[model samples]
Target: MAVSRETEPPAGAAELFGETWTQAQRYADLLSTWGVDRGMIGPREVPRLWDRHLLNCVVVTPRLPQGVTVADVGTGAGLPGLVWAIARPDIQMTLVEPLLRRVSFLEEVVADLGLENVVISRSRAEDQAGQFDVVTARAVAALDKLTTWCWPLVAPGGVLLAMKGRSAPEEVEAARPMLRRLGVSDVRIETYGDLAVPTTVVELTR
Candidate 1:
C-alpha cells in the first residue's frame, strides 16, 4: 500500500538532518513499508510521515546536551528517540519500549541503519532501572503520569523532555501538584523548530 501522498522527504529535510540524512531516509523507508505492515505505524500517517513524524522529532535534537545518555520512554516506531540517535551520533540513545512487535521493528531498523549509538530495551519505563542524563517521551501519557513513570529514570540534574501538543500548558497546570510533590520546580514550556506548529516540549528538570 502507498504510505503517503508525499513519499519523498519534504523540503529542507536534508539540510535539517545534515550528515545523517541518508540514514534518516532509510529509516523513513522502513517506517513507510515494514513499519506499516507490522501495524507499528498507522496507514494514515504514511502521507505526512516526513513532516509530522520525522521532522517533528529531529527538530528537537539540538536541545539535548552533548554526548549525554538519553532514554526515550515508550519510543514506539522510534519517533524522536531513533531520529535523535540518527541525527546526533554523539549521544548514547536507549529506546525504551515494552511491546514485543515494536521492539522487533526497532531492532531491525537499528541494525539496518548501522546505528551503533542506540540500545533497545524491551521493558516498560517504570520497570527499568538506572538513570539517564535526559529522558523523553512522545504521546506516552499525560504529564503527571509520565512523571511517575519517567522521573525515576532521570538522573540527578537531568531533564524530562515530554513532547506535548497545543494543550501543553493545561497539562502542566494540571500536573502542578504532582510536580511540586516530586520537588520539581524547574518546569518550562519550550518551542523548537520553525515548523508552522512548532514542537511543544514540557521540560521538567530534576
Candidate 2:
C-alpha cells in the first residue's frame, strides 16, 4: 500500500515537524503497508493514515516535558509511542503490548526505523514494573479501567496522557472516584491539532 501524495503532511507540517517531516512520511508509508497487512490497522484506515493516525499522535508531543521516559501502554501498532519516538528524539519510549504478533511487528518497525530510543515490551501494563515520567495510551480502555492499568506506571509527579475522543469530559466525570482513590492530584482535558480535526486528551497527574 503506497502512500498517496494527497495524504502527505499538510502545508504547516514542516514548520511543526522540522527535519523530522521526511522521517514521519516514511513512518506513515510503513504503517499503511505493514500496519494493515499485519491487521494492526484496518484496510479502510490506510487512506487516512497520515492525518488520522500519525499526525494525531504527534500532536501530543508538545504536551510532554523534555527528556522524559515514556511508557506507551497497550500500544497496538505503536500509535503515539512509535510516532512520538519519531517526532521527539529526546524522549525514551517503551512500547508495551501483550500480544505476540503486535510485539513482533513493533520490534520489526523499531529495527527497520533504527529507533534507538524505543524499546518493545511484550507485557500488559499491570505486569510491567518500573515507573515512567509519562504514560501514554490511545483507544486503550475506558478512563476508569485505563487509570487502574496505567496509573501504577506513572512516577511520582509524572502524568498519564490518554488520547481520548469527544467523551473526554464525561469519562473524567465517571472516573472521578477512581482518580481520588488513586491519589491523582490533577485532571484536565486538552485539545490539540487543527480545529477541523482536533485530538482530545485527558491528562491525569499523580
Candidate 3:
C-alpha cells in the first residue's frame, strides 16, 4: 500500500501545530511504513494517516494542561501519544507499550522526530509505577477495561483522557459503577474538531 500525501492538514492546522506541523507530516510518513511493516497499523490505514490518525490525535491538544506529565497506555505505534508529543513540546510524554516491536518502533520515531520530551516504555499500565497528570490511550480497550488499566497511573487530581468513538456516552454510562468504585470524582465526554466527525474523549477525573 502506498502512503498518500494528498491529504493535507485540516484548515487552521498550521496555526494550531506551528513549527511542529512539518514534524507531524514526517511522523505520518513513518507510521505508513513502520506502522504497517510491524502490523501495528493496517495497509488500508495509510491513506487516512493524516486526518484519521495524526490530526485526530492532535485535536486533543487543546484539552491538555500545560507542562503536565502524560502516560500514554498501550501506545501501539505511538498513535495519539507520539502525535501529542510532536504537537505539544511542553508536556512530558511517556509512550507505554508492552510489545517489543511496538516499543522499538516508538523509540525510533521518538529519536527520528528529535522529541526530547518523549520516552518509550515497554510495560503494561498496571505494572508501571508512578502516576502522571494525564493518562491517555487511544483505541486500546473498552471503557471498563481501560479504567482498570489506566486509573492507577493517574496522579491525585489528574485525569484520564481516553479517545473513544461514537460510543463515548454509552461507555460512560456502562462504566458508571466501576467509576464510582474506583473513586473517580468526575466524568464527562468532550468532543473536538469537526462536528461531523469530531473526536470523542471520555474524561475521567480522579
Candidate 4:
C-alpha cells in the first residue's frame, strides 16, 4: 500500500467507519458535483450525498481483500468501487455499470482523479470474465441473485465483498444452496455503524 495519512472521520464515526467524516464528505462532494453535472440529482439533494451515498459505500470497503484487484458490479454512481479506488489506489478496480449516464460520471471521476488503477466499464459484470481478483456488490441484490450475477467473475481464492443489511445472517442462510453450487464457502459478516445507513459486509470466499 502507498503510504497514507490516517484521516479519520468524525470522532464516533472513526470508531465505526475508520475514516473521518471529512473524507466521506469529500467523496460526497465529488459525487454530488457529478450528480449535478449529470442532472442525476438536484443541487439541494447533493448535500445529503454523504448520508445517502458515500457513507453507504464506505461501510463496505473494509470487507474487501486488501490490495487485491476488485470489480464493482452494478456500479451506479460508482460507490464502494470509486471510493475504494480513491482511498486505496493500491488495488486495481473495474467499475461496471449498465447505465450510460452513470458511466459518463464514472469516466469523469476517473479522469479527474488520475486513477491509474481503475477502469469504468459500460457493461454488466456477468458479461465480462476472468479479469478480477475480487468482486463487489453493494445493495445490488438478494444474496442468491447477487451470486448468480457476480460470483462467476471472481477468481478462485478471491471473494465476493458484498453488502447486506441487519438481516445478513438470514440472507446467507437463504443463499446456502446457491453458495455451495458456486464453489463458495466461509461466509463472514463485518459490521459498520459509522455510515448514516448502518450496514453489514457479507464476505463469501471462492
Q: Is candidate 1 or candidate 2 better by lDDT?
A: 1
Model 1, span 107-145: residue lDDT tens: 999999999999999999989878999999999999999
Best-to-worst order by TM-score is 1, 2, 3, 4
C-alpha positional error of residue 73 in candidate 2 after TM-score superposition, expressed in Å: 0.3
Q: Tens digit of lDDT per residue, candidate 4, span 1-206?
A: 33222222343433433434344445556656656767755566554555555566665666666788899998777777877776665689998898898888878777766678888788887687665788888877899999889987978888888877788999989999998887776888877755545767888877
Q: Residues 1-206, candidate 2, lDDT per residue (tens digit)?
A: 55443455666666566667777777777777888789998878876777788778887899889999999999999998998998899999999999999999999888888889998999999999899999999999999999999999999999999999999999999999998999886999999988368999999988
The number of the candidate with the highest TM-score is 1
Candidate 1: RMSD to truth? 1.3
Question: What is candidate 4's TM-score against the reference?
Answer: 0.79
Candidate 3 lDDT over 92-202, as tens digits, reads 999899999888888888888899999888899989989999999999999998998899999999999999999999998898888888888689999998634889999
**Displacement of the residue 92 alpha carbon in candidate 4, Å:** 0.5
Cα lDDT of candidate 1 equals 0.93
Could you tell me every candidate's TM-score relative to the true structure?
0.97, 0.94, 0.94, 0.79
lDDT score of model 2? 0.88
Off by over 4 Å in 2: 1-7
Which model, 1 or 4, shows the larger lDDT? 1
Write down the worst ten-residue block by lDDT for model 1.
Answer: 1-10
TM-score of 3: 0.94
